[model samples]
Target: MPDFITLTGARENNLKNVDLRIPKGRLTVFTGVSGSGKSSLVFDTIAVESQRQLNETYPSFVRNRLPRFERPHIESLTDLSPAVVVDQRPVGGHARSTVGTMTDIQAVLRVLFSRYGTPSAGPATAYSFNDPSGMCPECDGLGRTVRPDWDRILDPARSLAGGAVRFPPFAAGTWHGQTYTNTTRLDVHKPVGAFTAEERAFLLRGRGARVRVGNTGGSRDIDYEGLADRFERLYLKRDLSALSRRTRDLVREFLTDDVCPVCRGARLNAAALATRVCGLSLADCARMQVTDLIAVLRRIDDPVAAPVARAAVDGLERIEAIGLGYLSLDRETATLSGGEGQRLKTVRHLGSSLSGLTYVFDEPSAGLHPRDVGRLGELLLRLRDRGNTVLVVEHDPDLIALADHVVDMGPGAGAGGGHVVFEGTPGALAASGTLTGRCLRRRATVKRRVRRATGGLWVKGASLHNLREVTVEFPTGVLTAVTGVAGSGKSTLTGELTAAHPDAVIVDQSAIAVSGRSTPATHLGVMDAVRRLFARSTGTSPALFSFNSAGACGGCEGRGVIVTDLAFMDPVTTVCPDCAGRRFQDEVLRLTVRGASIADVLDMGPEQALDFFGDLDVPEDAVLRPLRALRDVGLTHLALGRPLSTLSGGERQRIKLATRLHRTGAVYVLDEPTTGLHLADVGALLALLDRLVDAGNTVVVVEHHLDVVRHADWVIDLGPGGGRDGGEVIFEGTPRQMLTVQGSATAEHLRRTTV
Candidate 1:
């Protein structure tokens, strides 16, 4: 019989016509250094094909309404099963999406409340805050009402022609700016700062008036609304994420995200709240941390509430296992970090009884501390033992240790990496000579002298949810680590501190650039220097050196794609056959810079690009500094032209760090910078932290990597436990001091390092 999932001659992207057989009901890990085509094989080749084929099973009319997916280039397949990819992608960006809704716990609560309690509501529907009958009358279902900011719109100083509006989407020369100035009743040249009482009130109040924009020899009438009011209608009421970045920033400058006043964050209507079970509303249960809810569930012995409470407890236990007990069910799904999102998704699959199915996971241990990693491992193994085949693309040692089989892909990333170098049991793979094997078999000792702090920042009376009058001091001009298990109030404390100091540099793992054209070179500001070098070396105008300018290949129009979104068919992103993915005209490629073309320079890895800059006669600037910093952070394997889409989430975080290196006298915050890194790369990243502190900037890092924690001069360890049992800083000291703390998970792990 064929293997449960057989991959034969699988010549997908970067793959070398591979062939493999995987068992149907065991844990198998895809291990390698990052960018080793693990994702290309799992997500691109297998998951996409399964989902695309599943979509095809639907009627053509129905399939047309769904997301389009292109079949990957592969030769053969057998014994394929339907796949459910629970990835690190945020659950939903819709303002309504919350943990209660995503997990369906709120629906269960609605049922429980409708059947039981004091002042009983009508039906289950009547108990749903999301329903109009249950929604708060004031805030509607959204629970939050956005009011316009008058100061952002009505400038009282400069006139309309002087660009006093000062907003991104409504600049002076733009269509919206012209419309406001051309209003017949309003004086165009009047300094907005000097506006009369009526003019100020009318302009700020969003009074709609018919106004002429630029004349076509005749007035073209359009509705003139206040910029503040127009902005609210356009972006504030809707999901700002759907809009482009430029538009989002313009609205963000004036809008403040606030809790809904009517629902008071209950996110439900008053009528629904009238129904209660055991003197507790559904929203009250949801607001409790997972750990706290579990306690509540255990105490409820009522026969009427028993079954529902048991199910809720089971779901909450799954969350705690995935290391998310600190999160409330009411927390918005969109607010979760990628690691948190990934783990939260795993909870849905944890209780599944389906056997003989292949469950694929991407980096299950990503945001987890070493203490939590063991739990993640247990969950993965539990899935495998439940008679399902578990395939995980991971770098975490704890997760890898639980694998029944390990397939190590690599020798490199991108064009250089593809073939599986080793495939065997964990012991055999660890004994092998591959880079992953070598790194796993070895370990690093903490430095004897971790950097020292010259000063510190003190936090007082800081109580932001669960943080219970917490006071802490963060070392200045050194690398201080906030070591904690998940949901240990790290984010709340750090956020409060950052908010207090507006100048603090925050380098989060948010997307660097999403458009296909945005590559590492462009995002890092290296493109301009590269263009100037090409211009000077080739004796041509700088515009001619830019692929986005005169050098654009006409056949592809510099996009390198002929994207045709067929109404119901898959959107095809085929390479520009005319330009052969070069993105520049053939004539442009012929114009060499020194010895290589502009594309060749872009093709160089960050390490190689550093040397090129050193060799060039270009002016020394902040550009080269960050590029070198990126290389030092172990991104040397990455090419400058590699699309942002192709980058791993960890690489994106490092890129964010590279961007913030220019900031001086500013406190820098890094959240899990070592995530998705190989053991070898972790050492390099740790060294980069030292360099950061030596430069006179304060670095505050939230991390689960023990190696990072071991090297920290001052470690603020949160959690005697996670969730309700956590939020208090249980230990604070140097790494040396933490080693003797008996109850601390971080301390125990550091002790093992000494051995």
Candidate 2:
């Protein structure tokens, strides 16, 4: 077996024909600026090749069912092992997925309960909530049921013609609205408030009544379902996760969640719930934190339950060993922060008996406070000790210090970066004058002159989650940093602040759920103006300039590629032969504004597009305003037509921030705006936050980066510990004052970073 994994002629993304060899069974940390090809090299190149090769080893039929990965542009990769990529992507499963289930610990617990309970269930399956036999009859194991409010969904005061249905899907002129407006059963012009009982029944709960739709020549008779029935079929029964953000937001307005009345939020059925061990039901056991659950499992000494309980305890102890003892088995995996989720994922792998395999982590220290970062480093070393190669792409200096080998990959970002600048131990790299080296020892001083609060919002008796019943005031018109260890209730306190002040603009890491076709131009609402300008110039309708409309290429429609599905094999996607992937018809391509076609404009980056549009005879604010926002947020390098789905989490957050920058006198709540950012990019982010504060807006950032915390005019530190040990306000003052305070996790770490 080769001692190293080697890559030759790797040119994926901005990588400039790079060639390198990495030692096997060693901890290697890849460092670089954001967009400097770190991901392109680590994920798109190495991981893709490893997984693709492994997929090829399986039968064609099996490969077809597996996820399809696009082959990286690298020429050759040697000595690669099967790679397991644990990304920061939310462990998204249905609402039924919990921490225990995701980690497979719950399965062991189920077996233990089924075997040794006083009143036994039939089998392990019978104790599983995911199984139909164990699922709650009312909520179907979801633990909560969504109740749609009719009053919120309807406006009885308004007539059908006046848009009585308040929901977006059933609004006026929509197809669902037309179902009632064209019906002959009731008066379409009449207000619903004046309807008789029969009329109301016909309008809201009509049972397959025939309704006429469209003109007589093109008309068809359709079965008329009432709004309630249609809504249940259209929205309520569908998977909310798969829907667009806009549609999800619309659906959320009329829906409220309540605990299951039948099983009382215990996802298991009555039979499963009736089975108990040590007088505690399965639901009760799940509610206990992992630390407490360990004690409960230790008491169950029945021979049949012993082995099963041992496995459960082992997994639970592994999770607790990683500083996650505060998390409960019943906690939804979706609610866990990126840092917590990543740690939980690491705990899953710690039990793996396999050796000589490669483990890849993307920013394992992300969302972790400086204190917990040391624990993360220990976990990485543990993986290395298990005889696995641990490859991490990280920005945190603490993790970098633990690296057995360090590979630095840039002097800048984007086009200017990708060359391997240094390759050595962390100590040597620190001494070497690289950007990462300098930033490692750099210290940001506390503000000398703290900005006074214009006003304050008081959070009184706030006791959500791990947070104690605490009252605190968030000063307005200043940049405030909320620092805490993982699970220290920083999110809870800031969340309450946002809830109390609903008018504040929240820019969190929640996905920018636009359609796949949605681009920066479309999202910023600038495409309309561009289309109008082209239409006016060419003496055609504005629709002629839109690929989604009349001017689309007839062969591939608006999409640039033709996707061909090959059963039992990976699908093939080829460029559209008709338009050569331009996504526009010949006639539309012939028309141009300032000798540039619509396709040409879409290809331009934000900065380039702004310059091009400025030279043209177009409205200044119409094009420049939105383009400037992108530039202001350091997204000038992004192309106008780049898909939002392809952007990084940091990019998405910045784009969201760009949209809200113009709002004055509004508070801004940002949750880890530094995520996915390079150390160099953080300075730009701090400047952006300064602009917000200078604009007379209160800015509160929930961050773990020492740079962000030290730069803040005011600092609010939460936690003397995490979980049950955390949630109190340990320190609240300027960063300088915070350092002088004792026993604060944030202060302890801050003291180390400062000169």
Candidate 3:
């Protein structure tokens, strides 16, 4: 067997014909700037190829049913193993998916209950909420039901044709929306408030009602469903969290999640609820926190339940060892943060007896508190000890310090990056004069004199989540850093603050919903100005320059690619032959401004756009302002026409921040702004925060990075520990003062980093 996995002339994405070798059965950490090809190399190249090749080994019948992956752009690979990618993406499951179900702990509990309960519930299937026999008929095992807020959905002040229905899918302009307006049942011209109770009922709750809907040629009679009935069928029946961000937002505005009155959130039938083990029902066990559950399992001294209890206790202990003791077995999997989700994924794999596999982690330290990161390091080491090759693409220096080998991949970002700068031990890589090395040792000084508060926003009693009823004051017109271990109520504190201060601009790492038509130009509101500029200069209709309109390629319409669907195989996407992926017609391409077509302008990066438009004497405020906002947020390398869907969570957060940069006197609440940033870029982020404060804005950041904590004017450190033991304000002062304090987790970590 080969000692290493070798890649010869690998050229995926930004990689410049790179050749490298990663040692097998050892832990190797890849370090680089964001977009410097670390993900391209680790995920796109290696993990994708491994999974694709593994999928091909099965029979043709099985292969056809599996997920199809396009072959990577890499030239050659050797000594590859079956790879398991444990990423930061939330453990996405339906509403029924809980911590127990996801980690297989619940499955074990179900079997134990079936066998040992005073009254047997048939089998394990009879104790499962996912099973028909055990599921509560009222709630369908979801334990909750959607109740539309009539006040939010209906505006009685307005008529049906005048946009009385506020929900997007049923709004005045939509096809379904037009159906209501064209109906003869209720007077469309009259206000909804003026209608009789029976008329209102017909419009809202009508089931078998018929209506005449307008068509292109004429009107046709169709069986019509009421708005409420249609909404329940389409949106409420599905998982709200799994929907697109836009749809979720719209649903949240009008829908209320209430506990089902019949089952009362137990999610089990009467028979399953009746079955008990040691005086505790299966429902009770599911509701208990993991730590609490361990105590319950330990007390099970029954001969039949002993072995089952032992297994449950062992699994629960492993979960607690990785610092996830705060999480309950009943907690929804969709509610877990990226950090919590990643840790849970690692916990699942730790119990596996499998060996010789490649375990790939993408920034496992992301969203983790510094104290918990030590535990994470130990977990990674355990994986390597179990006779597996562990590869981590990371930015945390602590994780990098624990590596047996290090491969530093860049000197810069975007076009300036991708080549391997150094490959050796962490100590050697540190002294090798590389970017990652210098950043590892970099120190940020605490502010000498803290800025005074112009005003204060006080939270009298914030007892959300794990947070105890604790009162704290946030000073306006200064930078405040909220530091804590994972599950220490930092998010709870910040979330409440944002809710109280509705005017505050919140920049978070939540995904930005995007369609195929959405791009940087359209998102930033710059495409219209650019189109007008082209029209005015070339003396043609502005529509002629728009690919969505007259300028679109006749063959592929506006879309640059032609998708050819292959049944039972991977679909092929080829660039349009007519316009050759330029998206515009040949006539539109011919009309150029200063030797560059509209397509060429869209392809330019934010920095390039600034320079190109500046030379053309375009107004900076009208055109360059939005472009400069992107560059200011450290997204200079992003193409103006690039799809928003392609960007990472960190990139999406920064993009949202750029839109609000022009505002003043606003409270800016940022959640982990340094999430995907390179070590070198931390200073740049500090400088930007400094600028925000100097401009008289109040900035509050929930961060784990010591560099960010060190530079803050004020620090509010939560937790002597995490979960129930945490949520108290352990330390509230400057970084320098925090260092002098004892017992606080943030202070202890900061003290070590500064030294």
TM-score of each: 0.92, 0.92, 0.94
lDDT of 1 by residue, 707-755 (tens): 8887787899887776666678889888788878988777787787653
Off-target runs (Cα >4 Å) in candidate 2 are 154-165, 171-173, 178-209, 215-217, 514-516, 537-541, 550-564, 572-597, 615-621
lDDT to native, each model: 0.78, 0.85, 0.85
Candidate 2 per-residue C-alpha lDDT over 1-755 given as tens digits, one digit per residue, 9 for 90 to 100: 88899999888767888888999989999998776678778888999889888988999878988987766777899999889887888887778899999899999988888788868878888988888989997898988989788788778888887888888778777767788888888887888888999998877778867876664367787899998888888887888878877787888889888998998988999899998888899999899888889998988787877888889999999888777888899899878877778888898999988888888999988888787788788988988898888899998888899999999988776566778888999999888888888877566676678888899988989999988997999999999999987778888999999899999899887767666688888888889999999998889999988889999999998887788877655557777999998889999999998899999998888888987888777776667878888888888667787778666567777888887776789999999999988787788899988998999899999999988888998998898878888889988999889889899888988888887
lDDT of 3 by residue, 152-190 (tens): 888899999999988878888677887688777789889
Where in model 1 is the C-alpha error above 4 Å?
A: 155-173, 186-209, 215-219, 224-229, 256-258, 298-305, 500-502, 564-572, 662-666, 695-697
RMSD (Cα, Å) for all candidates, in order, is: 3.0, 2.9, 2.6
The window of 10 residues in a row where model 1 has the poorest summed lDDT is 147-156
**Which candidate order results from sorting by TM-score in descending order?**
3, 2, 1
Look at candidate 1 and give me any clashing residue pairs: 129-268, 134-269, 135-269, 136-269, 143-260, 155-192, 156-192, 156-193, 156-194, 157-193
The list of candidate 3 runs beyond 4 A from truth reads 151-174, 177-209, 215-217, 241-243, 515-517, 554-577, 615-622
TM-score of 2: 0.92
